[model samples]
Target: MKTFLEVKQLNKTFQPDKEVEVTALRNINIAVKQGDFAVLSGPSGSGKTTLLNIIGGLDEATGGEVLLSGQVLTGLSEKELSIIRRDQIGFVFQAYNLIPVLTAKENIEYVMRLQGRNQEECDTRVMEVARKLEIETLLNKLPSQLSGGQQQRVAVARAVAATPKPHSC
Candidate 1:
């Protein structure tokens, strides 16, 4: 399978006020292929979240490189990275990070709107994901109106709805 995401020789460290260096990641490397449902499982503070953050472009590495597809993410400007993240990547966090005021459907549509996807595509993807996840009935319900699982399902839908760019985490 072709590589969809690649991390090579990645490293990240935290320097405390006392000047103690804490290594969060060290020479870490991973290659996830297209359509791979890969999971980074480990104990707490085991660098799973740190690796994900690097993949998601939410955190910068102290060294090394991440190439999503053939593009080097570290070289991209913040604005460009933001657009890439908004348009291509989908994030499913442990928490349901949804807007309490927005209905399930609206929350799903938010990313599409930000990406300027046409109404038809947005509707199609939202409906497809909602149906696939059996959340169609909760489309009009706010985050507060749904159960934890339902909200997380919606979050997953929103993330997967976007067609990823040539390479996205």
Candidate 2:
């Protein structure tokens, strides 16, 4: 079996100036096989988000490599990274970053639309995930109209609707 995600000697550093430097991550290593479940748990300020951002292509690592299903993500151009992110990774952000104007259903359908899926397919997948997540009744509601848990559920539904795509931290 091949690794779905791999990180090796991952290092991240922040240098604001000659006198100021902070190391967020150093020599981090991780591997996850396809269909496996893994978790990253730590207290605040533990570089968890920094590591995640680098893995998701939302941030650059100062050193090391990230491989997603065997594709090296470190040196890819922004557009290339964007394509990988769109087609290969689904992110459920901590803040539940739903578009304020779009209803739950629309928010859930957004990624599918970006993937160039037809309306019928997007709608079917959205409904399927909504049902699975028990958020079908909240589809018409705006993000502000739902509770935190509901918003999180919708976010999860949106992430899951983009099925067969690997999810990032």
Candidate 3:
């Protein structure tokens, strides 16, 4: 399989003060092949979220490069990155960033709606993903109405629905 995502010499640094520089990641390198699952697990404060943020284009790296299907993401403008994120990537944030105003079904359909999908298509995709994630019963519930696990399932459903490839979901 071809390389789906690659991170080369990745680094992230946080500077709270002029004299304090904390390095979150350093010289990290990874390559994920198409259709493969990679898990990152470590102790807390190990930069797992930082690495994921950089890979998802939600945060910037201080050095090195990230490639998604051969497109370099290191230096793109926010607009360009947002376009890629909307069109190609699916991210499930830790906080379950579902809209407070939207019900579970509407939250799953949000990305498809933003992509200009018709109502029929969005509805169908949302139903399919909700069912696949076994969240069909929770579709009408608000984020606040659901339990933590249900909310996470809804978040997964939303990301799966928005993904360009269902296989990846």
Candidate 4:
């Protein structure tokens, strides 16, 4: 049973210079095996998003370790983390953050371009993911032209279009 993701003894605290410290998480431990489906559920402000952000490398954990695949991500430099995020991870935000001026196809192709993929490859991948998501016809429309659900589908297409390589934290 290979671990796909692991969080060990994790803790997160926020301290303002003139205010009391707020502890967001404490001694959290989690292990997710490859191909497993896990869900995090809690009430508002229960640190679900915080834990996700930390796991995604969008925020730093105050203490403990995060292992993705077999990589330790806790102490990596921002540049290194950026590479990891670009090559290994995909994020779909609750708010669909599409570029207003870019067409749906362009939005879906953005990350692939950032990864230096060739134009033909980018185009192919964008169409493939869009078709899979049943948004093939919407690819030429702007974000504002799409419904909320359509926009969310485009965002998901964008996240998966690059077929980012998977690696452990």
Candidate 5:
């Protein structure tokens, strides 16, 4: 099968000042084919989050490329990257990142709404994902009202609900 995700020569560097440069990642590479599962495991400060941020289009690498399917994500305009992120990437942040004002149901529906999906579709997807995640009972609760575990579950639900299957490569 073709590679579903590829990271080629990935490098990330941080320069806090002209006199100081910290290399976070260097010459990193990864490939995951369709239906494959992979994990990034490392101690803190080992660039795991940095790598993920680049892959998820939340950050840019100082060097290298991230490709999803066959599309190169390097050097895209911010607007283009935003569209790609919205349409393709799903992130479950370390922090739940839920909007405090929106209930769990609305958090799950937020991306679908941004994608311009109709209300019926958003409602249907929210219900479906909430049921699959066993968060149906928590739908009306705001993030502030949920426990840490519940918030994480809702975060996962939101990511799963927003991420559409990749188009044919």
Candidate 6:
């Protein structure tokens, strides 16, 4: 299998003041291959979230590099990063972040829309994933109307609906 995502010597530090610095990640390195189910499990404040952010391009690293699909992530502009995030990566936050205005189906379709997928393609893919996860009934319900597990399933479905891209959280 090919490498889907790779991080090398990744580091991140937070500076509240010139004299005070908090290291969020230290010399972290990891890779996920195509079709691989990767898990970043750790206790709270254990850098799992920090590492996820770097992999998803949601946060910057203080040192080292991230490569997704052979493109170096460092020095990319915000727009470029956004394009990469939309085109190549899909993220599901632990928080179950869903749009307040969009229905469950709409939420699933949003990612396809961002990737410039046609309406028919988006609809078919959303339905496919929804059925695979057995969330077809909840597709019309709002996030608030669903249980925690249901919401998490929807998030996963939305992330994986676009098969052309690698999805991460």
lDDT of 3 by residue, 73-149 (tens): 99999999999999889888889999999999999899989989999998888888888788899999999999999
What clash pairs does model 1 have? none
What C-alpha lDDT does candidate 3 achieve relative to the native structure?
0.91
Please list the residue runs of candidate 2 whose C-alpha ends up more than 4 Å from where it truly belongs after superposition. Answer: 163-169
Residues 1-169 of candidate 6: C-alpha lDDT, one tens digit per residue: 7887889999999997889999999998888887788777989999988888887889999999999878899778899999888877778887978886788898888878978889999988999899999999989998888888988888888888854743564
Comparing candidate 3 with candidate 4, which one achieves the higher lDDT?
Answer: 3
The C-alpha RMSD in Å for every predicted model, in order, reads: 2.8, 2.9, 1.8, 2.8, 2.0, 3.0
Q: For residues 63-166, what per-residue lDDT tens digits would candidate 5 score against the true structure?
A: 99999989999999899999988988888988989999999999998998999999998888888888988989999999999999999999998888888844
lDDT of 1 by residue, 1-169 (tens): 7888999999999987757999999999888888788877999989999888888888899999998876789767889889879976888888868888899999988898888889998888899888989999999999998888898999998898875533454
Score residue 121 of candidate 2 by CA lDDT.
94
Residue 147 CA error for candidate 4 (Å)? 0.4
lDDT of each: 0.86, 0.91, 0.91, 0.90, 0.91, 0.85
Predicted candidate 4 versus true structure: per-residue lDDT over 1-169, tens digit per residue: 7998999999999887748988999999999997788999999999999999999898999999999989999999999989888877778899989999999999999988999999999988887788889999999999999999999999898888865534566
Q: What is the clash tally of candidate 1?
A: 0
TM-score of each: 0.93, 0.93, 0.94, 0.92, 0.94, 0.90
lDDT of residue 105 for candidate 5? 93
Better of 5 and 6 by lDDT: 5
What total of clashing residue pairs does each candidate reach? 0, 0, 0, 5, 0, 0
Better-scoring candidate (lDDT), 1 or 2? 2
